[model samples]
Target: MGEKGEVSAVGASRAAESRKIINVVYLITALDITWIFLQLSVTPYLAKKLGFDTLWLGYLQTTVGVIQLLGGPVFGRFADLFGARTALSLACSSTVVFFLLLAVANHPAMLFIHKIPTVFMHVLPASQMVVTDLTEPEKRADALSKLGLCFGVGMIVGSMLGGHLNTRYGETFTACFGAVGNVFSLLLVLKFIPRTTKDPRTNTESENKSKSIFNLGEITRLMKFPGVTPTFLVKIVAGLPSGIFQVMFSVIAMEFFKLQPEQNGYMMAYLGIVQMVIQGGVLGPLTVRYSESSLLIMSIGLTSLVGLAQAYTQSVFWFCVIVIPMMFSLSVFNVITDSMLTKSVPSSDTGTMLGLSASVKNLLRTVGPTAGGYLYMNYGQSSIGLIQFLVNMVVFVYLLLRPLKRTEARKE
Candidate 1:
């Protein structure tokens, strides 16, 4: 009886510790995302001040994308090897440097130089790794959806804060604010997040033998795992159009909508609010009621429809109204895909898989911006929606033709 009670005590203590770590992860994720949207709010004005044209802006994102493409898997492997706390520290440190450079940037060359540190900015992937580490397989989808809630909160606050500061002060002040926020994030990671114990499932001897950060062989081997390839392909195909739209959105706001910085901030905040409601209030119940495959298919279909609606909308009011379903679809789709990918791999490779996923999106960002810029310049904003509509429709049809295998599908 005494032995059983001691075991119960140990289990309870471990559970408490896991919950504490998860809560800290949520806090750090929210803070980091806040800094991101905050930086985004002022980047357009800074680009204009530096005399960047639309094509130049595309080139800027492409530069960061190229660096991240090389770094994503490395950082993911780093997390897998060293643990998420270490990876988060490195990412936060890079962000602080990036922001400081942005604050002092006076020319387009400086802007390009500043993005060099983005190679280590894998905060989101690392945080996702931490969550997957702690959560159970059956509850993973619901747990991951809460990250979207953090994202929404950060977006709402960060957008509003950045816009207010930039409008009231200037771009430099806004950049400095981001730098400070990330410094605090770094401190939180170091102080609050506990060092994770090695998973019993991990083969320490083999992992130690392959500790090189950028092992293409290892990444390739992981990709060959059952269900990984097709899921990754779907993520890339479905993500490309949205990725392009996101990278070029500031340009769209400035040129097409004629939005000033504060107005753009408010628009982002509105979108954030919708996302929060869906992820926080709506998605938890939906995940409980339906299978992930059903949710994935439904979200894709809805997103394709939203894309078609966005193609014809001319006024800001109509655009705002249309964005509600768009946010819901996007939030649902992202959570489901990430959950599925993590579950498909062994416990050891979660970070690496997420890193590969990040690399895929970064690859899209690298090419999508340049193409999106040219298309937006020549064909107007409607072309963006047209691409989204067409790509998502194809993907939706593909999913219908061949649904995910049982291995990939979440157990209800």
Candidate 2:
């Protein structure tokens, strides 16, 4: 009877811990929402104010991408070496300052300085790492889906609120909106996440043998594992279109559709709603029903088809209809792909691997803005759609031809 009581107490403790973690995820959604709000239109507004065009906007994104590519790994290593909570707290605190910089900057060039600090102090990867650390193996994908829902819901609120604010308040002052979310995220990190949870692998090793964050050899050795490389490539390729589109969307809507900031906000809100419904409520059950390989392949193929459908769509009504499948597929793909990658590596390296995942996306994102912007300017807005369609096709065909490699899974 005493043993059963002890087991019951343990179960209760775990349940309480899980609830706290989920609450942390909800707080993260606020941050994601604020971010989406700022990016929806404020970025382009600043660039145009500085006498820049789509190409210049692309340049800014490229610069951010380059910085993120390098800094992402460093932060990942920080989370691993120190702890996710420490890294996340620092990231949240850094974001508060970064937004302040954006809010006060007189010139567009100053935005680059803002992104420099952000390169090393990002919360998304760190936050995901936190959830990864707490979740069970079978439930990680579902847990990740909940994270995705936060992003989706945040997008809905952020985009709509951003539109309303941008229309009413103008650009520069509105930059501080995300800072509000940062305050809350920082508080949550300080209060809930543990100060340190050192990796056993590093602890077992000699202090001098611990790898440096700046060491190229360390990063190279990380990829030496069986499933890491291919998984990274798949995520990069599958995610590129969305990455490009994310930066380009506001610009495209403004130019092609002649949309007001509020209208653009509404469109993004609609997209967010679709993402929220699918990722938040439906992803877990669907994950149970299908293998990651099958779902990924199907989602990629259908997403390409949806891109093709969008290329031909001129009206907002039809565009709204198309957003459903696109959001569903992309959200599902992100969840499952992340699950696959995290399972590919041991627990100790989860932070590093997740950071690498962000780096690859950022690397591709560096080129995405410039290329996507130029294509939008010189070719046509529809051209961006065509490019996405083709890219998605390539990814789908490659995945279909190759057997999805599931390396020996080891839980941390």
Candidate 3:
């Protein structure tokens, strides 16, 4: 072949591979949202129905996250040793089983205990790796944006569906249906995903060498990269608002506002729709036009405003009106922040870096829910907004002072 023709062919081949990898990530994100909605939309109602207190419900979910923090690295190592595809497939399949078990839990302890195993398998490290595996460093934002879009769309659908199902059929039925979705998602991964591993198909002695079950050292080394450290901090900061929103929204809807189960789901569905429109439909194109850093700042700033509104609003209708804009900004913020991290790190370390970050993020999440519950039960719903506003403000300051410079430098 001529030189130019040969180069064109090579580029096309790489592009095709990248597309396939992105498809896998999109599938994972779709499943992830479905699972999250199933958890968020149904779990609180179930807890309430079962006569569990706010603290008990929060403790149950927090226990799930605690296990995830401990399990994520072990799974990361397994992904490295086996293959990401294998680990991801296992994660998908296991989630289906756990969701089924979760469907049957009548007691709080049973529900809490059943939840822990699934948390490990929901390790986001795999999906993040799929993005890094597919795209070049310069193209990371575009790639991550696509993944984020899938999450946004899926979340909307899941929240809406969970609301419909729970309202129509009841919590147990909704949980069972979500399990079925997990099974379907597992099938999608099995059919679409390709294994990306350095090792050969056959096991070698070197690959079999006993590595420490917990390699704090290896994870620490990975974090030392300049690109990784700040990204990790960003993930930690991002976790607070997200965690608070996730845990507190349902509590406020169910407990303080005295909304029915379906009403609560519908409110979340509304948030999901606003977020999806902004993140999935708008943010990707906007990133190409505007400064992603500015968008990030705006999003965080707006979320704080929403948080404050959420704290003080007595009427659900007024709360929804304020929340519409908040959701839009949040959706954009997550896409931007994640794109930054995906762009910062090298492809080879994607799994380890994301796994470590997931551990830390989950740890923060563990705190947010418990704290949010405590605040809500004692001080009332306004406490959620106050805490979220403070945390996001701290994050916003850090962004302007530090990362804004980095983002501007990149743009220039």
Candidate 4:
């Protein structure tokens, strides 16, 4: 009876810990809504005030991408070396600085200089690290997918609030609002997120051996893990087409769609609703029902179809209709890919791998805007969709021929 009681106590304790970690993940996810909120509320207006054209806007995104390309891996390593709480606090602090800079920027140089802090602004990756740390391998995809609920909520709330705030007040006021929100996020990190201890899954020897954040050699070694390289390559290649579109979306909305900040905000909210329904509600069951390889192949194929549809879209109504499948596919692809990468590596390296993933995405972002701008300026918006269609179709075929290995089934 005593032995059984002890076992029950341990199980209960673990269950409680799991609950606490999940709650923290949700809180972190919610706090990150501020980023999308600021983007919708103040960035567009501020860019216009600072004399940014579409190409200039692309330059701005490239600048951010360049910084994140460097920062993502470093911050991820920091999380591995230290803990999720410290990394999150650092990320939130950078966000606070970024908003403060945006609030006061009167020149293009100031706007450019403000991107410096983006090197550490990796709240989402750190949150993923936390989730990967605690979740069961099979459930990791579902748990990660659920983080989109916060994103969807932020999209709806942040977009609506940012639009309303900007319309009523001004871009500066909205910027201040974002700064305050980030400050609050930092406080939440410090207050709620626990400090790192020795997790059983942690490879203490490796941790002790490598404490440097800028260890490129160590970072490169992560790819050599059994299933990581192929999965990472797939994520980059498969994601590039949509990445370009997303990077240039603000410019497209303002130019082609003739949307004001308010209208764009509404559009984002609509996307959020779809994302919430698919990611928050549908993806959990799907992950349980299907293998990651099957889901990934389906998403890639669907994305190709959506790209073709987007190429011929003549109005916002049709664009909205097509984006339903687009969002569903992209959301599924991201969650599954992330889950697969985490499963490929040791638990101690989850943060680093996630950070590396973000870096690769940032790599795409760095080039996506410039490429998107050139295509949009020369060939027209239809070119962007056509490129997406062609690229995704090719990738889809490649993936079908050589399907991703099921990393989840492998023993660590």
Candidate 5:
């Protein structure tokens, strides 16, 4: 009877693992497709169309970041008490509604107000929990890389498709398609993600211990975790520059190169293509062989160079060419940061840590766009790129200041 029971348990465990893997794949694909239209294509287009100043863009992101800071812990704990799938589903659905609103948002303030809650509470927290729920410690980075690849590929396709659609059909039509894509993604989640009590925090005897509901305290504890502290600093600096770049891409295209909306979209599409190839096709496999620290350092150095290149470039082709390495570096850095955090964090705390990290990152990025706008307005395009390059240099130097032993461990 004992042997028979043990065999049965083993069979059940295998089945459960299989189910989790399937669910992870489904979630990754769904989110990837939806995010393409939301982030890379629509947001920039809207920024340009609405005539949002750099300060307004910063204010918008800052509000989101602040909300993320306030809400991340709450959401993270919620995932722990309830389940990741439910939390993720709610977050994704919320994003759908917010992005749909962007379709008709004519006022900068209106769009900014709508975006704050979406960025802070929904997008970052959900993504962190979903990835943590699906991956093991050793394989966390690998798993995240795969997930990132899905999004990268989706962005590549989405940018091209969105640009083409907007040019051919119109922004309204393209946004409708985006809404439809998100609806399909939500449906996929409902169908594929099973309701399971699979958090590593639960004990062996209580593997099926059904919890009451989400809690906020769990998230607070997660924010205080040692593993996440350093990464927060790095994320803040990186996000500032990235956020600025994100908000101003269209503006730069218009003012500097005198490119049309469709042409700007095309450039983004090309950049997305490079990111897709680098992140989805090349980076993951290389990660297995090289350590995270090496990759992180290299990504930072190259990104700085790319920033410098951008500062000097006057022609559209040169600007586009420089973007290739920039995107690649960004993707690699994100992968490494996530992987490191996952490995260092305790299983129970993954959701909270992820949320907090995102909150901080969003907060920092929020500063960038607004500041970039002011800088561009006052100093011109060359000055903006030069300052961004300086920011990257400081990041590089700060990381170097850490002890060699810890840095080496991070690579491992």
Candidate 6:
């Protein structure tokens, strides 16, 4: 082709890639909103049906978290190998199957069995890989913020409506509906999402050597990159409070503040709104203005204070006030961490590095709930806050003291 023809072809290809990214973003948002719509409806009741004590629920959740941890890197690798569309489809499909299985389950053990397929479908890193695939380093954070915004939107809609659905339709009906929604998500993947231009197997020599999706050795080696280890560690710390508090938040609210189900639902919806606002609107603009390292550090310090406030507060009004900054801190921290991850490693190894990040995050998540449950059960509710406070402060100090230049957000 002549120069004009070549330029036209490149433009056409860019146009197609842009369209696909847009489609994937919209579809993922819808899929997640639908999934959260049904999933959260069941969480409040799952333990009741299974006759689970708090400790047992913690163990069960930890087990699920463990499976997800094991699956994260694999999914990352799958996205690298099979393409983000395929890996995401599998994840949604597995979620559909898992919900259906849960609806029919006679025992908690059945829920465990069904979660086997649940591990491999971790879609966050894979969805992120898609963004990384299509965007430059500077653009990846904004792209990722959109994904987080989708999750926030999902949470808001789901939390707003989940209570009503569970009350009106019943648990089995609600779960089955969630399954059907995921089926639609799978169909969306099959129909509208486009395939990648490059074959996964036909990469550069280094990429070819790291071809297998389940290559633990390769993933570990990737951690040695300049900004990779510190950012990954920070993410793990950021995730810990969630593991400790998220599963038990409702319990604490009900117990300490005498909150009702309706109030809890609204509170959760508020949290979702805060997350969406910060991640979708605030985070993207902030990245352009500040270094990711500084923003991440800010998030940690803020969350630490929130944790402390959470420990001392007795009034529901004060508790609700705490949620505002808490959610903001978390949302900003996550978006910045993702941006840092993209900048930490080479372009070709993006998925693999992200996979490792997801894997370690799950490991922390697995440990979080179990340990948090213990602390909550034995010590007190404030114990969760105390630990979170300490952890965030420690991490914030460490990151501030030893900043990595590579993880700074791009200016040019």
- Candidate 1's C-alpha lDDT? 0.87
Report, for every candidate in turn, its global Cα lDDT versus the true structure.
0.87, 0.77, 0.70, 0.84, 0.64, 0.72
- Backbone clash total, candidate 4: 0
371: Cα error in model 4, Å: 0.5
Model 4 clash pairs are none
Q: After superposition, how far is residue 87 of candidate 3 from its true place, in Å?
A: 2.0
Tens digits of lDDT, candidate 1, 196-219: 533655656446648887778877
Model 3 stretches astray by more than 4 angstroms:
1-3, 197-213, 237-242, 290-292, 402-412
Q: Which stretches of model 1 miss by more than 4 angstroms?
A: 201-209, 408-412
Tens digits of per-residue lDDT for model 3 on 196-245? 63323323532554466366776566666556576667667755766766
Model 6 gets an lDDT of: 0.72
TM match of model 1 to true structure: 0.96
Candidate 2 stretches with Cα past 4 Å from truth are 197-211
Task: Name the 10 consecutive residues with the lowest summed lDDT in model 6.
Answer: 197-206
In order of TM-score, best first, we have: 4, 1, 2, 6, 3, 5
Model 2 CA lDDT for position 50: 78
Query: Against the true structure, candidate 5 has what lDDT?
Result: 0.64
Cα deviation of 72, candidate 2, in Å? 1.2
Give me the runs in candidate 5 sitting further than 4 Å from their true place.
Answer: 1-69, 104-109, 116-128, 200-217, 404-412
Worst 10 residues of 2 by lDDT: 198-207
Over the stretch 1-412, how does candidate 6's per-residue lDDT look in tens digits?
6999999999899868776766575557656664754565566466656887667767777887789888877777667666666777888888888888867867878766866775875766766776766666777777778877777777777766666667677777877877888888788777766664232444554445757767787767767877677677668866688557776775566555665545666776777788788777887888789877688889889989888998887787887788889888877877777778767666656677677777776787688768877887888888888888988888878878986566643221
Q: Against the hidden reference, what TM-scores do the models get? A: 0.96, 0.93, 0.87, 0.97, 0.82, 0.90
Q: What residue pairs are clashing in model 3?
A: 311-382
Q: Considering lDDT, which of the candidate structures 3 and 5 is the better prediction for this target?
A: 3
lDDT of 5 by residue, 271-331 (tens): 6677767776788787888877777877877777777887789999888778878888888
